[model samples]
Target chain A: MTFARILQVFKKEMIELRRDKWARFRLVIPPIIQILVFGYAATFEVFGVSTAVLDLDHTQESRDLVSRFVYSDRFQIVKIARNQQEIVDGIDDSDAAIAIVIHPGFAQLLRKGQTAPVQVIVDGTNSNTALIALGYMNEIAATFSRDYMTDHLQRTRDGPPLRGALVTLEQRPWYNSGLNSRWFFVPGVIGTLVLTMIVNLTSFAIVREREVGTLEQIMVTPIQPVEFILGKTFPFFLIGLGEVVLIAGVGTLWFGIPFVGNPLVLLLGTSLFLLSTLAIGLLISTLCMTQQQAFATNFFVVNPLFTLSGFSFPITSMPTVLQWLSYLNPLRYYLVIIRATFLKGVGLSVLWPDMLALAAIGSTLLAVSILRFRKSLD
Target chain B: MSAPDKPKIRVAGLTKRFVGTTAVEGATFDIARGEIFGLVGPDGAGKTTVMRMLAGVMRPDAGSIEIDDVDVVADPEQAKLHLSYMPQRFGLYEDLTVDENIRFYADLFEVPRKLRDERTGPLLAASNMEAFRRRLAGQLSGGMKQKLGLICSLIHTPQVLLLDEPTTGVDPVSRRDFWRILYSLRESGVTILISTAYLDEAERCTRLALFHEGRLRYCDTPKRLKALMPGTLLAITSTAARDLHKALLGRDGVMSVMLVGDGVHAVVDDADRRVPELSAALDAGKIPHGELVRVTPSIEDLFVGLLKDEHAS
Candidate 1:
């Protein structure tokens, strides 16, 4: 309520911010790098996957099967291993992300008009990418089986089906036709960068004061608790908001991504999300005493939050429990809002529930931070 | 409480507890207007805890603090207007320049723009920081930083100033300069309460309160505290000062013998009477000796004796 005191606090924060070039850099660079790292490097479109094959049959049929996988552009045959031990060694050494085994009986079974099973193994450590790689492998194998069956049936006096020889499914992707990994990633990158920068920066503010023995200095003044918390939080709040704008602009103009949501609604969502993160950061500051502790704790919490934020994988396809867990994650909400606004063109009416949830989380976090901060000081 | 118009600050039965440990137990003290009172003790003696409670940064487990007759517990905000506290580290914003820090504090205390120019000039001059006004506080030396901290604490010009070891690591010259500023503030009728571990700094205070194990051992003027020494203190220097120190441990008329630096200082009862026996013992040991003049007991010596006496009882 004391505008003068709040203004004083605001001035103090800005002065401190302007002095440390690194902290300011951290505030900006973290988000920018996160946008690029998460946007470009992170993807569901698995390519150049190191795959090996054990082809026991040296017939044309077996060679044709191998050619099908090579032609799919998904897997690169890294090696043709001699036996299962070599395949196991390849997987263990991470030299290959997938392995396919074709038995010697494969060609003979095809000539005898019998189906033969081909075994495929994929590393499931990074389960999301592994799953995508598995899907690509299945598509290749299915096409090879269809081609062999059609050739064999013609020789057995069966003609092509009445519904034309074959029908190729035509895919038309809306908004992002190329499904550019950059387009899908940039918005989430913005969300994550803001999340880490705002949370880490604000989280250390109060703890740094405590470590340097300055909290007592500020507390002895006539400033109220709410005023102090808000004063310290606003600059970071604005920075987080600014980061979203900067990243969105960069993502759109430089990266060729589209922005279709109502600007006002988008800003409102971002503001709530940033407010939530700032509160969480402030709450962490109250719990930690030293700068190192604050840093460690922030990183520990942020790692999983970013991983499970639906930026890396689709939440809808995850197991029901994990999907439900995403409901409690603010990153999930923010990611949804960002992707919707930037890619889907959805507005307030469709996204009101997410906005409300963000607001609730932000308010709760702020209240909890203020309470803990007061208790710690007392 | 003393008389109705006794002092500008009064604390009665102030206690502070941390988890299972009691930091300050029933700490009672008073500081008159325009006086420099110090809480003298080593670390963990609850000096900082007491100051924090008085500053309203912390709440007491039990007791009352009154600043210029305002109840600190009932209304801490109003009470804060009458006091300014600089914590141990002085809380300098390293990134901000010297002048910016001062202005920031001034703004927090709501000093008007017109009055800000009038007050900041002398403060900066007193701190000898006028030339470095544009320099970041992080670039200042240890002493200048302390001076700037003092200036920042004084920006509001509160009636009472609470300092928690403002000169702990500062050099002697800067410590002296800091005390000079405090003296001027005292002359201007501000009540100053400071906590310090340095005995020499405690000697300059108008009054000193000795604290140990969360209890006050003694509180009086420096003169009166030295007068509280029940017997004479003699400085003893010899070739075998350590051996002689051990020999005088349980001897009659020997109050205490403590090693201070290279020499041992012995507190004896009637130094004139004990000198002959001390000499005879030295003769048996065949150790050359230096002067054994009777000297005033220092604040360190006084507190050590008090703690020993309390242990004996």
Candidate 2:
């Protein structure tokens, strides 16, 4: 409650942090590395899939179909096989992820307006990549068939050519026009990195003091438990904010991820998020007796917060039990605010519910941490 | 000014238990104003536990601690305003310099800038640590660290100062310097309650309390405690000191035999009557004895004898 005492503790902790070269280095370097590493490494978009083709027909129609597959950037033809055994060998050697086999009468069937049996083989070891690649192949085949039907029908029927029976659907994605996965992951990385770093930094604050015998000395002073907790956590809150800005900058400048939201809204949301994380850190510190115990507890707490926050996986896809658990995780609300602000350029009106959730969870955690900290002092 | 007859600190039946073991049991003592009181015991004798309860950092399961007329258990913050405690390991921020550490404590106690400047200069000069103010606390030698710890604890000029084993691992020269600081504080009317493992250090205090197995064995001035020794102590030296020690163990009038540096110091019921009997016993046992003389009983001798009696009972 005493502002002067709180400020005194805050200033002392800040000075120690500034003087410790190792701590300073840790504050800056790891977040930047994490921004670069996770932004690029964690993506679901499949590109440059090595493909092999086995062609039994030497006709122009088969050649043109093979050329269509080669032109799409998603598939790269690594081998052209003459027989079935070679196709199997190429796949077994890991030289190709997809294989296409065309029957001998493929041109004749297409010319005669009959269905052509073409087989597309895919490696299922990486299921996500395989599924996306299959979608791309299906789209390419559908387009080729439409083009053939239009050309053949236009030449045969001259007057006001009748349209085909099939209905073509055109797709346009919003927010992310190109559907680049980087835009999704980079902002999420900011949320995860800030949460983890701030939690770890503050989690060990009190336990380290206890281990080194300073907590006993400080307890003998006239400072209250609330003042002590405030003084210990406020400076780290600012440091966590600095890390947010740093990682966001890296995400925007280095990775070309857009920052489309109001800076003020981002700041507000970030403040609430920092409060929750810092409170959780103080709570962990109160429960533990040593820095090692604090570190271990942090690992158990942060991993679930990160995973269930929908950082890499969608919360909707998680089981019902885990989905409900994610609602209690403050990082989930923060990630929603961050992604909405960064990608959709939304303001408080769009993110008010998430922001409210964050405030509710944050204040509750802060109150609990304060109570636990007071008990620990006794 | 406070009344002279009133005690500065009062305690009654302080007890603390940890899980399955009792750390301090039914301990009661009073410390007068402006006196350097010492709690003397070996490791695990509840010295630290007693100091912690008095400092208000820890609460006893069953006890009443009144410091400067304030109940520390009910209102520790108010009690803490007039007290400072330096734990067994005085917590100093290792990354901070000595000056910064002192400033931090000054701030926590809300000492004004003017008063801090006035007080810090004299304390540093007295401790001879003015030159090392800018050195990091982690970089200072062990002796200097202890001095700095004392300086930090004394910055706010509290009425009562509690130090728990402040000189356990410190070198002898630094230990002497530390006592000098305590003496000056005593001259300024500060009540100091210090715990120490060294019997020599206990002798420097105005009064001492001896603890064993979480219980108080004796509490009085050092002179009075030494006078409580049961019998006359005689120091016996001989080339066959070990054989003579064995020969004199069960002889008549011999109460106890303690080995002290290549000789045996024994307590006898009557020195006049027992010395001849002891010599005759040593002669019968074919032990050659050199010199035997009476010596004053030290605090160690008194405690050892007291411990033996407690065991026998």
Candidate 3:
């Protein structure tokens, strides 16, 4: 456990990494590419949803209502349908994801001061996209109805004195006023990419030597198990830290996602998260005998760490059993820390508990790995 | 016995077992300081198991190992400070250059920079590998790889060196060069334990331990091992060598018969009488042959003879 021995190992690892072309490619190329792709692709907001407009009431009022969907910037009316058959054809052909239908008595019903119902039909092929598009349609229709009601009341000034001044609600969204999903996704990429690179690298560290028959060579030296493990994993820890900075800076500056929290808080949270993830890799390294076995085990291990961590799917939405399992996944806690830091601008006052959980998991995993590592050496 | 006073390596009742099989059972031996000890046997004879236990890379299931006053089983790390082991087919990092591999190992052993430079310079030159230092370890020939492995193990100048079949696949020329480097290391008083499949290599060791089927069948000098043969050996070279082999089996005065390359080697009670009798038999079979020549038993001849004896009883 001496520092000198550990530093020697650290130096060797760095030199090896510097020379390994694939390793260098993984460190530099993939993080940038992943951030570029995942930041934009992993979005909950769906725009340009092709819609078919079927306006039976071909009046100025019907035309004006159809314009609302177009102006929402979320839909494109690719087809002007004459009837239900045309709308059906558009949706069946996959040409339109949704259709806005106005009945023939739509304007007459509004003129009579009664309710006018607009039927919205959606394609459910990709349920997530369908669900998000449906939400956007609801918002657009609500705003149009509110405006039309106000205008109708002004034209009929004698209408029962209008109870309670027509109940107008003003909504204010905090932190992200326009609610950009990239603001949420870009910061999470920092955690995901760091987890992926550091875990995969560290997990293969000892196993590669074992497969190539160098581990026995190392074990025959005076280097202790703890010293070797620290030396092996610390280099990846530094790389993961550098990546967090690179991604956080890129997300905030390049992608225009705001970073409103204390950098020190973000740094602390990230280091703790890196500690646990690197320990997880070391544990995997001890359990595996070969690089291929390590890779297979990593597939099972990392896939769960990614999916179960509320990266794309919310843990609260999962079953109670899975939600409980997510508690053990360090990524779940790190996600809360990273998302809160990027979006909410909160610090340790809000994130101390998750930080503490990370410390506990990291230390426990590291201790176990060191114990198993020493045993495996013999 | 040539250790002068105290032995550098001692073992008592060393044993290791895998599930449903024993790898080494109650093995006991001592290696003196500065002795070039050979672990000799055919493949799967537990030679490697014995070498691994001595190197402290593996723990004996039921024995004690004391190396330089250190209990290797209970305290392998301490024992490691005194020994360097080159396992069978030692794998150097292919991506690293030869110099980088050496420097990396030197650092692990905490070799001082000045001392490392002094030693590495001559070691590479001695092995004629000084020019290849910058080359990646993967790019080197198999023999060069084994040489580099040996060099890396020696950077620490350990008290004991363990080499497991370092020349198993190397060319004869490289193997000669390899033995030269080992002889020099022995001159420096580094006690070495080398396990080899080639019986000729066993003759070069100051002492040899013959392992067979997980047991040490014989432990002594190569000279003494050949002295253990039951009778004089005769070499019968013939064109019909395979037939000559069958003809010599189960004959009186003949203790054992083995078909060697283009010849048959047999141990007999009396070489003179057996030669005449064997010549008569070969003549009856019309097997054209050369004159029967009496030769000293080689380590291989002795190993084959011992293995035959073990199978008999």
Candidate 4:
């Protein structure tokens, strides 16, 4: 309503934020630390899985297979098993994550142009790690067998066995040619971190006043409800935007993630995302009566935003019911826009749908929060 | 839009309920311009509820509240321009300095810098808080925090000020200083309605309203209300005061008996005659007793008497 009143509240809040040591710490230090921490910690690509090898063949072919595992930089051989019992001990003791067993006839089978049977055992404790390890093992074995077969065909002058299987396919991944997981996660850290910071900042800012009894003090004044609400949320919106810039800077400069899309589109997406998160924070503030309650509710609300927003997991892999629910998550759309813009270098033509989704969700949330804000002014 | 003859704040039949229980019922009062009206009651007497409704912060379920002849329930915003309310715990941003806190409230009320500074200087000096202007509110003494709350509330030069238990937990010295500032504000013609749990503060108010269990028991000048007390109150002390309460109940000369902090306060029909009669009776019962003194009737004395009267009838 009145710009002067709203501006005053905004200025007061900014001053408080600046002077509050704990709030300042939460805003400045954690985002940088979290971006650096999560960029490295939240990756999906598996490397250097501890492995045990039981080579009974004692032949060049068996050694070549073991060398492939080493050269691939995927499996680190922690123990060369003398017997079957040792391989079992390595896996059971958690000293090794996976074990490879090459039979005694492996070299004879390969020389006679027959299939080589390789037995692999894995620790299934962390199912995700086990699965990725299996995938890496499969690729390395396929390459080893394909190279061996081509050599055999050149020496013996015989037709290729498993013709289609030995077809040398060269895989070139686009956009993140290295398929680096940091490239994916760093861009997303900007979203998750910003969401967390903005929500906590906005929610705590209002609920702390209610707890401290300032909310009622302000309500008794001549200030309009709209002006108060605008004043309360705008600071957080700017803080959220500033956070995006902070994390994006760290993401590009420190983590070496590329920023390829138009800055305007990123800014637009950040604005919409901030609006929705800040609305969510305000709504939570209205429901709570104390800072402790606000903290718990923010955790309760933001946890789902992270998990269901496809920040770490794929939305398509979720159950149909949850997939439908993801449509309501603002972070879900923002993550898509962030990852797309950062890696694919796509523009509005490909991102308008997500942008529309974000706008719809953000405006809807903001309207409800404002309505609730007005109602709770008493 | 106020007529010269009208009261500054007129609240009629104000009632409010929360969930299924009534917090304030059929409360009616008026505050004249420049008057210090004290709403005195014990905890849960609905004093704060009445102050909240008058401040336009809490909407009464059924009532009309007019501040400066402006309808409050229907047009709270318009009425609020002339109103300032201080809650039981005046919520100051503790991270902010005292000066910053005052400026924030002034900005909220849209007070011009020239006027705010002019008023703040005198008010701060009167409350003796000028030295601590730059201190964070969280770091101030409890007494000074209350003074700052008053300063912030008065920054706008509002016509009506509503303070709910502003000095409930403050020290005696600070409370005296607070009352001195309030008396000065009355000179400027600002009608103040303050809710307090302290009955002794009634002596400082131009008028007082007594509340008990969501109802206004008495509303008038403190002098007039004290005159309405039915009987003389006798302060009887013995080796065991609880025993005195039981022995005096339903006695011939005593109307009712109550325990007041390790002593018995007996409302007797006539203190002159009842004092000797009670002394003789205590001797007969072998209860060790002291000389009886007739204590002046206060708002609390009348409240205890009114509660007894209600229970008897």
TM-score of chain B of 2: 0.94
Instruction: Kindly report the fnat of each predicted structure, to 2 decimals.
Output: 0.88, 0.90, 0.81, 0.91
> What DockQ class does candidate 1 belong to?
medium
lDDT tens readout by residue for model 4, A206-236: 8988889998999988887778889988988
Best by lDDT: 2
lDDT score, candidate 4, position A188: 91
Put down candidate 2 lDDT per residue, A1-378, tens digits, no spaces. 789999999999989888888997899999988888988788887789999999898888899889998898999999999899989998888899999999899999999999998898898888889999999999889988888888889889979976678975687988899888889999999899988888888888788898988888888888888888889899998998898899999999999999899989999999999999999999999999999999999999999999999988889999999999999999999999999999999999999999999999999999999898878866
Reference-based lDDT, residue A309, model 3: 92
Candidate 3 lDDT over residue span B47-148, tens digit each: 888888888878788999998899999988788888989999786988889999999899988999999999999999988899999999999999999999
Cα deviation of B219, candidate 3, in Å: 1.6
Worst 10 residues of 3 chain B by lDDT: B1-10
**In model 3 chain A, which range of ten residues has the least summed lDDT?**
A159-168
Q: Compared with the true structure, what per-residue lDDT tens digits does model 3 show for residues A249-321?
A: 7787788998888888888988999988888888888889988888999888989999999888988899999
Give DockQ for candidates 1 onward, in order: 0.72, 0.70, 0.64, 0.79
Model 2: share of native contacts present?
Answer: 0.90
What's the TM-score of chain B for every model shown?
A: 0.95, 0.94, 0.95, 0.96
- For all the models shown, what interface RMSD does each have? 1.2, 1.0, 1.3, 1.0
* Cα lDDT tens digits for candidate 4, B28-129: 887789889998877898988888888887889998998877999998888788988899999898989999999999999889999999999998998899
Most accurate candidate by TM-score: 4
